[model samples]
Target: MQLDLTTFILEVLNFLVLVWLLKRFLYKPVLSVLDARQQRIQGEMRKAAVLQEDAARLKQQYEARLADWNTEREIAKQSLEQELARERDTGMKAIQQSLADEEAKNRVRAASAIATREAELVRNATSGAYRNAAAMLRRMASPAMTLAILNILLDDLASLSEKRQEELHKAAHPENVTTMEVVAAHALEESAQRKLGDAVAKVCGKPLQATFKTDTSLIAGLRISLGESVLHANLADELGYFRSQDKNV
Candidate 1:
């Protein structure tokens, strides 16, 4: 099975021509299909990675925004609480001041009213006392008092000297009684005047002159005169006489 050199060379050349034709047509087309599939898969993987990174950034931003909102809410709540407390304190203080002012005003009014009432009562009491004094004085020293004085004088006559009695008789004679007059007015009724005249006669041992004269300033009483010596027995004069008598008694 040994071949000749020229025939072996021709067979080798034909085999080389077949391999070149298969590589150019079938092998190159199949390799190109596989490379295109690999490139498409790599592009899809790259797009997925980029989307994941964007999602992470968005989640962080949302968390930050929520925390800022919570802080703002807390600050607003504290501010509202402070404002409410201030308002409450102010209102309570105002109410207390108003109450104190009202109480002061009420006390002042009560004191004023009391003062007015006291003044009115004092006036009424004083007026009543003055009226009572005037009336009592007029009654206590009148014809009745004059009669009593005359009786006392008569009783003392027995003890007096004859010379002194004579002197008294000359001064109080019936002839001297002409100028003497007893004080009287509407205050001295007819009965009072008659009693006064009797008393005067007994004291002087003579008939006395009596007259009804209205001197309203004497208020309400009698005045007796015998010569220059007068007994001004007026309503106002009675109090001194009674007080003197009380001291003696």
Candidate 2:
């Protein structure tokens, strides 16, 4: 409570000096530290904002990439499905074609077998018919029948067409002196032989002479021979000719 000017002034001066020292050393350093901290916090906040924007962009890119991958996968699946379908169809067609070919071959084989069987049956029937007719003719042989057939044969030779006559002339070689033989189932009378020789000479267009022979196995009729050529109207010759024709059929 004592009003001392010097003490009061000194106390005031000392207080002022203390406040100045604190401001220069402690308050200024504390304020600088606080400012640096504020600046660092603001910089961190800005960096965080930039990072968030980049994260958003990355998320969008990832989603777009996923969508593109899904689309590609779907396209690939469709292509594979189409390929498989094509392969299956091709396989089915191949199998069907093979079956058709096999069926056609079977039909051809069956038809050929049937035709062969029919031809064999026809051959057997024709052969039997030829044998039966030959047997029947052999049982009915006679000397009178033989003479009649010989006369008919000479008549047939006389009445031959020009073309057939020429063929006979060539075969008989009447111009060439050759041995000609006339065979019969029965021996002819002298008058009949002379008449037959005259008739044969007239057909030959040359002086013709023949040697006659008898063979009972001829059944009936006559056979005339010149070298390898034999003209006959005998049952055996007729049967043999018909047998050849039947075999050809």
- State how far residue 16 of model 2 sits from its true place (Å): 15
Off by over 4 Å in 1: 1-63, 124-249
Q: What shift in Å separates residue 19 of candidate 1 from its native position after superposition? A: 16
Cα lDDT of model 2 overall? 0.80
Which candidate gets the maximum TM-score versus the true structure? 2
User: Per-candidate TM vs. native?
Assistant: 0.36, 0.63
| Positional deviation of residue 140's Cα in model 2 after best superposition, in angstroms | 3.0
- The true-versus-predicted C-alpha distance at residue 159 of model 1, in Å, is 37
* Cα deviation of 56, candidate 1, in Å: 5.5
Residue pair clashes in candidate 2: none
Candidate 1 per-residue lDDT, tens place, 1-249, comes to: 898888889878877877777777877777777777777777776776777777777777777877887888888888888887888788877887887787777777777778667655655554465557766655554555444544454455446566765654666774545656665423555765666666556555677677666554454455566675565555545544554454354
